[model samples]
Target: MNHWLTAPILIPLLGGILQVFMGYAPISLRRTLAIATTVLTLVSTIVLLVLASDDAYRLYAFGNWQPPFGIVLVLDRLAALMLVLTAVLALFCHLFAIGGTDEGNRQFHSLFLFQLLGLNIAFLTGDLFNLFVAFEVLLIASYGLLMHGGGRARTVPGLHYVVLNLVGSAVFLIAVGMIYSVTGTLNMADLAQKIPTVTGENLSIVKAGGMMLLVVFALKAALIPLCFWLPKAYARATAPVAALFAVMTKVGVYAILRVFMLIFGNDAGTLANLGMDWLFPLALITLTMGVIGALGADNLKTLVAWQVIISVGTLLAPIALGSTAGISAALFYLLSSTWTVGGLFLVADMVAQQRGSAKDKIVTAPRMRNRTFLSVLFLLGAVAAAGLPPLSGFFAKLLILQSAMAGPQMAWLWSVILIGGFFTLIAYSRAGSIVFWRTVDGHIEEPKPLGGNVSTAAGALIALSVVMVVLAGPISEYTDATAAQLQNPDGYLNILNTPMVGEDG
Candidate 1:
């Protein structure tokens, strides 16, 4: 298992190939194959994670050249944490994909595996160009997944999805080229070292490169001005597709946190030298606008999409705070929100599908009287997203506010955070008020026949939600570790890009 270092990349690569081939097989066999391959990929990733967690942060040069001279896969606290999150989300999506899967869909397995592969690669790579390659892998897979079996449903937004991401890919390439031109290397740790030594004309070039790079990551993260593509595209997708859609934007957000912290934290980094003065107001407005959008949206699925945007903006507050505790809070919030927002979307889809669609209006059949599931789902979702106490999200926000409040002269932005939380409360309140209270003729009605294994997918989501409550302690510790690791960059750079005997000479 020397490839264990490369297993994260190779697992999905093989699984994706299997999926594409299986897509041409009989429907029953195809689905069974998809599930098995995905689950195997999950197992592969978990084994890798468990093995890596016990070891020092390390690197594997793909072609045997060391450090700055070779393309490498690096494992450290942050990358490992993202790998775990992606796997958890991917597992749930596959579970939900089972029954929600459309008939005659040509390449469900192929696209799903490829998407997962891209995410894992993005998480594992220690190089910037490789990061861009991974992003494109994800983009292309997502394009196919978002539109598959969507028919007329995906056409309009699918157009935006394709054209917009293609443009993003182009801009991303240009950014990579700019960085390589200036640094003469695309390895992340090497760039972190060279970025400080970089001088003269490249200073402005580096700044422009950083800004353009941020633009690319932000577009994917759905940060405010660049967030237009998110809701429309996600809202138009099928349920399982939407579930997977939640994981995709997060990769972009993760990139911003990873790249910015490593390169900028190295020396007078991007956010530090800039004091977040570069775009604090814009991020604040993004937070406000996302909350407002959630307030106005009527559809359950679309509302969930807006909430994802809200979480991304709330996440920006701490990056602006630029303190250890502030980033610790952001890490906590990121972990909880990713779980909550993604789980909520999948559950909403289940309810919507049972009730006929995701419309604001309730319309389940009189015989389909199982309001219990909806009640449980909405209660947890509202409590989770709104940051109610006794839940992980609440603890995260509390930690963030503590840091933001204590930071030097960030009170204005901190107040915006408090207001942002209130707006989120209101938005979640509006959704819950209608969803849990609206009278249907069969509010207490019995569960209607769901045709397949409803308990499998729904049960898994419910279990994950419940675990968020029970596992808060250990999860918080892990988040703290990741946050602290981001604050101190030497461990990551030292491990991955530091030259050994033959390489540096």
Candidate 2:
């Protein structure tokens, strides 16, 4: 039962290796192989998520090694949901890339699987060092993806993205070294047991290590001060690439939820406690700053990038409140953000193609008396992203608000969230009217020219939007269960100690 858990992590590694070696195949065939592999990985992840819906969290060890000594990979509700979501986004991005990419490149396809491999491992790993390695894998892959177009637009931001990630990697390494020095063991469960009991000098070291690690994660997660890289990076990348990158930053949020909430436990997260006090304040500021940035941005792609930042602000709610409701809200937000952002990028890609532009560098569309068909869908997606009611985003925001209203001192940030939401709505509406609405600006391209193939890749993206709406109910239920697991970390012991039988669960 437990061994099936490793399949999500292993499948991509093996597939990526095979793709990289078969370098001699035609570019089209190579892409077909990559999409096929991504689909297979997606199937495995969905199976794992469904199988674990009712099971206790479990971990599978390689070569039958015990924890506090050997490596461990965990499969709790949170990680399972993320794994399935990552696979789905990766598959869409792969398909979307086929048409949305004007460059017709195959290398992006090969490296993307490695990127998927890294992310799944990061979500699953039970040790600090292994997690850092997984991030490196993701970073290396992103650099290639970011620079795929081989022009000034991609090249300039590729440098910034790489440098920023390198800094993040450095901070992550320092934190890992500090944790290992203080605790003599790298396994998460072992650290969970040993950390709470430390006193005086050792306790100070633990707090410092936690803070440093959180700082590193904040940067990766695109929270507040460290989020400068997100807008420009995502804006320059292709639309599908940006959608996939949205999943990338959440990796940090996932780490915080799994490590700080579960492994570090209540003692580290309490308001009166100084251990992890920064999460709350940082989240509020991030939410506000991200919304302001989103509203102020003049272009659609940049606006969408800032929207991703806003989602990050929401993701921190659970960790900040240090309560069950907060955890639940955070899980719900993670699910909603992934869906909304994925849909926005997909529609944006089509909108970009229709306008005959990329990154909204220039909106070559003409204005009409009413909105275009694709423009209407684009606005709807953006509105959903901003948390309008009856949408997945609305339910997600409602859950977080509910959590904050019940918790201590959290009600204050409600104003900030609402203000951010307002600007977000205004921002998307403004962009909607400008690029997608009537071409009153005298810059509208020929109207009613939906004459392209519409591409199978682009269709895959539209499929994702449908998935978000259709899967919302079931996903929301699973999110509630995810929160429950984080609030109580007991099953984590079972995950790490449980023996495997048929497949990696």
lDDT string for model 1 (67-178, tens) is 7776788887677777777777777777667664656576787788888888988988888888998988988988888887767868888898889888888888888898
- lDDT to native, each model: 0.73, 0.74
Query: RMSD to native for every prediction?
Result: 3.1, 3.4
Q: Clashes in model 1: which pairs?
A: 264-269, 369-445
lDDT of 2 by residue, 312-352 (tens): 98778546777677777777777767866876776665666
TM-score of each candidate?
0.91, 0.91
Off by over 4 Å in 2: 100-104, 267-275, 357-371, 406-408, 440-473, 494-505
- Please report the TM-score between candidate 2 and the true structure: 0.91
